[model samples]
Target: MAQAADAEGTVVVTTTAEGGRAGARALATAVRDQLPADRPGVVAVGAESGGGAVIVIAVNTAARTAGQDASTLVKHLLHGRGGGSPELAQGGGLPTGQLADTLAAVPGMFTAG
Candidate 1:
């Protein structure tokens, strides 16, 4: 897995799996549960597989206080490609090799949004 953490408490993680969507989902969930909760921020996680790619965005309580909604922001960023609740969202079928670039852009997402 590749992970990046920002000063704002946002984290972006990427991984590759042989199982595709299922594997991506599992990893995203695991990472979300492992993130620190001292501050609110976005957890932007992704996984790429033979079939396609998966992106999941999760948020903590502090993020809410900052008016940051990971799900909504992700959907907007991906042009309405994903689906999820206010706190969590998932999108996939991105072009192969796009996960890394996308994850790298996540840090700027909060401030830009």
Candidate 2:
């Protein structure tokens, strides 16, 4: 069975069923769905600089993210793209490399919205 991790915007399930892309696509969709857009004042707040790709999570535009600098965290959570802020965060890239490490980290992070 492909095991999908339970990160806020991801689902990491172990499986060679479809060469992995299937699960990865599922994760992207989940991320887009979970991103909060109609939450009223519950805005994300922040800023990031540089010329890397970005993954924007529609939450707020704050100055910091989960724990790291908005920009850095954005790079860390790529899904083919990357970007961030306290109110809004973005991440995207090949879910390979540190993908396992990222998925492993999901358990320690906040799960339910």
The residue-level lDDT of candidate 2 at 87 comes to 37
TM of each candidate vs. truth:
0.76, 0.28
For 29-62, candidate 2 gives per-residue lDDT tens digits of 3443444433211111112223222223332222
lDDT for model 2, please.
0.35
- After superposition on all C-alphas, the RMSD of every candidate to the true structure, in Å, is 2.6, 10.3
lDDT of 1 by residue, 1-113 (tens): 66556745555444454456776666666766776776665666677655566777777666767677767877876778887877778888777678778777777765544
- Give candidate 1's root-mean-square deviation (CA, Å): 2.6
- The pairs that clash in candidate 1 are 40-62, 40-63
